[model samples]
Target chain A: MRRTSPISVYLSLLTALLCQLFPWVGQGVILRPDFMLVVILYWLLRSPNLCNVGTAWFAGLLVDLATGSLLGQHALTFSVTAFVALTYQRRLVLFNTWQLLAYVFALLMIERVLILLLKLFEGNENPGFMYFWPVITGLLLWQIMILLFGSLTRPKTN
Target chain B: MLKGVHQKLEPQQSPAFFVRGPSPFSRMVFFCALSVSIMAADARFNYLSQVRQGFIAALHPLEVLANAPSEWTRDTKKYFSEHNRLVQENYALKEQAFEQQIKLQRFNTIEAENTHLRTLLNGNIPIQPKAILGEISHMGRDPFTHTVVVNRGSQHNIKAGQAVVDSKGVIGQVTRVYPFTSEVTLITDKELSIPIQIERNQLRAIAFGEGNNTLDIPYLPTNVDIKVGDKLVTSGIDGVYPSGLAVAIVTKIQQNPESPFAKIVSTPVADVSNHLQLLLLALPDYKEDELSKVAPIETTATKKELSNKNTALIKNKAKANAPH
Candidate 1:
């Protein structure tokens, strides 16, 4: 594993925030990925020493502020997701490519479900089935992040 | 046993001693508690509004940077539009302006007559609200809520509760004001309710947002005098919206035998997504005017009392002068 700097994690998180802030209109909004969550998960998995639960929690707060929803809605979900990711950090080295993908998918689903529960509790409308559309897009974004930054698992040897 | 095995197996696998200050579970618990308190405080109090405003103000530059690409694309598209389209648009606008001018002429006489009639009835003059034109910076980031951010804000003299309207009709009301922008909650949001009167029969009722692109007018009798095509306009009773502004058109009416109230649904007239520009009407300070009206009534009562006293004195003087 390459030693990473703290600045790189923060810079990448800021770039993800910019992507999240992009104006998405009409039907496209439903498909908008949780860019910050995917990026934060990447750093948390890659360098837990530098990107910890506190980093995820702060990033979630920024998401909450940007979305202008209730305060701490995203923050709570993000920290919970970070905890799950960190708990499984030691076992990631043994995970194959498919297993890693499944792990990321579960994390994304956890974040989405947490948000849906929060929204429902806050008395928002059911938002229909389309509310889960972000999960699929977020999965795709996670794959892209892995492709760009390299995979978290070791290469298979014959 | 697994912990002993793991610790005994790999010393290098553990995180650096300096970097691992606290357990992830403890950090997660602390953050979760902190966020829950913040959520409780934010939902129950107004203390965080100032903090939210300052943070949003600081984020303005970043938002502008993010918006640049879309703005550039729109500008390029506008610049590349064909000349014929511009001419056609200009022609249509000219025709619209001409028709509006003709209507204004009739409106002037009607307004004068309305003033004269109101004065005869000792009614207070209606205040015409001043308006500021603003462009929608973006739709609300949260899709679950129906809100839009307008470029006008506290810096632009925008106050919460101002009426927002498009050319077609009332759009919504300003709910929050930041430094360089304000949040306008649309008429379709669950929290907003408007006082409306049917245009056909002048039946007054309050319509609430159902949060599903329709307004619900409940509490009306199941056999109320309303139809599917009836138009709803501002009743002006709440003093927020002026009378006769178009609000919505009745779309569905469901009368349930089991329930006492009718399920009347209406769609707002303003196409919130169709327009980029909207008008924010300034809030009317009618309370001060109402107080002034009360002051005049007191003065008039005192003057009447003085006249009654003078009349009694004159009557006594006449009796003295008549040598009775």
Candidate 2:
């Protein structure tokens, strides 16, 4: 695996933040992936030493500010999801590609469910089933990340 | 010698395996607590509005950059429009303006008559609210709430709580103001409510947003005077929205026998999706100091009335006590 630096990780995360900031008009917003979450998950799984739960929390806070939702709604979810991902970090190397995909899918679902619960608590109307579309889009982005950055599974090296 | 030095450096550096600080559980607990407190402070105390505004101001440049592509596309589309279409549009606008000007001439006389009549009755002068034209910069980031960001903000002296209206009717009210942008919470949002009156009867009631593109009027008797297709307009009792502004049209009135209150649903007249430009009406200035100074007699009258009520209450209490 190629060595990664903290700066590159931050740069990629910022680029993802920019994408999130893009003015998604009309129904297109429903399909827009949770860019920051996907990027933070990538770095958290790949380099947990450099990117941790705190980093995910901060990114989530930025998203909260941007989305103008209650201040810490996304932050709490991101931190919890990061913690779950970190718990499985040690076993990730042994997992096959399908298993890795399944794990990421679960993390994305956890984030969505957390947000839905928070929204309900805030008295927002149920946004309906389309709210989960981001998870599918996020999973696609995760696959692209794996394809571009190489698999998280250790290669069979002689 | 170089290889020996590199090997020595590698051994001195902490390996990635040992570099993970503070277990994930602890970090999660700490961040979770921090975020919960932030949410509490934001929701209960409103201590974080300034922080949000400062962050949004700092993020303004990034916002502009993000909006640049769409702006360019809109500008290009405007540029490539055919001249024939432009000329036809201009001709239609000129004819419309001429008709409006003729109507405005008659309105001037009616307004003067209204002021004269109010002066005769010693009624308070009607405030002519000033408005600033603003364009919708973007729909709100969260879809669950019906809100839009306008180009005008605190920099333009747009204060929170000002009523916003489009050409058709009332759109919403300004809920939050930043440096260069403000959030207008639409009347269709669940958190927003507007006082409205039926145009035909002038029966006043408050309309609450139903959170699904409809306004609900609850607590009214099932046999209330409201009917489907009744026009609802601002009552201006709360001094927030100006009186008589078109708000919504009553669409459906459901009288369920199981419930005591009638369920009247109305969709807002403002087409938030059809237009981008809106008017942010300036808040009415009813200066408390001026009213106190000018209406001293009125204040004394109210005070005397209150004192009389207090004495009557005390007399009743003493009568009951004496009997005991």
Candidate 3:
């Protein structure tokens, strides 16, 4: 197995965190992609040895801090997402692009549903249709991650 | 394809693959359980607030790094502004200052008289909360909750539970304080509730966020003397927000013959979306007697049988049954 340096993974995660922190105003904020989640998913798929469930859990904690949601809400959902993603990491090699996208779609949907349940239990009013907008935007961002950083599977050569 | 398959088969024979530690299934189950318990401990109890505060304090530098570009853009935009606009703005500001100076003279005398009157009445002098001025670092990342992170936090003596206000009115309350940043949950948030009085009739009611940038004053009768454009201000019975600060302006009132109560909606007067500078008022000293005072004040309105005393009992009963 080829070994990858840990520094690049961390740098990429930092960049993604900054992107998540970028100022968004008005309607654009509703459709803003979950940048940190997409990046953590990428690293979990690409280098499981370097970025594990613990790393994803830490990233979610940062988001919880940044978003100021309940302290452990995102951390709980994200760690579970990372664990789910890593479970299928090896089998992902046999899946095609459509299958990979579908898998990521499910992971993001789980995170949303988990957060929704938490919010409801905490007595929040239902957010309605707009709550799911991020999952669609995050899926679009996943494609960009694959295009720029290369896929999780073997590199293609002519 | 045949040659590539033969080459890839060699790694499968290696014994090192067997030593990849615990199966992913057990690890997944273990970690999932751990996270679930942590979530429960956080939500149902107060076990993790300190841990969260420390983590946020540590994350402050990264937040500033993220905020630098926006700060730079705001500064540069100021530097390259048109001279004509600047002159007009300067003139407007000078006129405003002169007008405000005249008002300040009258205000000083009125304030002194008001203090003297309160002393004679044996009323407790309202404590002036120390405020920390902070800029909105960003709107909340989660669209589900209405919150804003300010650049000032515990480092600036800002604490959770402090009231936040802009020039126009009450905006929100500080819910979380990190080292160099804090989070303000706006009055429009579902978890926030404010005690307010109708400026027209002085009918005091509690306003709760309906989650659409509007507040709901539930349980008031349909025949209540409230109209559109009525002003609502903090009643300050909660001892958190100071009394008589503007809160919202009535936008719509719906009376349903089928229901016992009128549906009133008001939009917050504070322009939380457009402004950066907000004052975080210090957390108040919680006094049990202040809560008890909520009921007595409700009786101040006189309808004979609907005397302020009965109104107070209604409030106390409502507070007992309320789902907050």
TM-score of 2: 0.88
For model 2, residues B167-261, the per-residue Cα lDDT tens digits are: 98999888888899999989988888888999999999989888888999889999999889999999987666889999999999998999999
lDDT of 1: 0.86
Which one is best on lDDT? Answer: 2
Query: What lDDT does each candidate get?
Result: 0.86, 0.88, 0.79
| lDDT of candidate 3 over B215-309, digit per residue (tens) | 99999999888999999999887667888899999999998989999999999999987878998887555522332333211111211323355
lDDT (Cα, tens digit) per residue for candidate 2, span A24-115: 87777899889999999999999887899999999999999888888999999999999999999989989988888999999999999999
DockQ of candidate model 1: 0.79
**Docking band of candidate 3:** medium
Deviation in angstroms for B27 in model 3? Answer: 1.4
Best by DockQ: 1
lDDT of each residue in B51-129, candidate 1, tens digit only: 8889889988989999999999989999999999999999999999999999999999999999999999999888788
Candidate 2: pairs in clash:
none
Model 3, which residues run further than 4 Å from truth?
A1-3, A154-158, B1-14, B283-324
Q: All candidates' TM-scores?
A: 0.88, 0.88, 0.84
Order of all candidates by DockQ, from best down to worst? 1, 2, 3
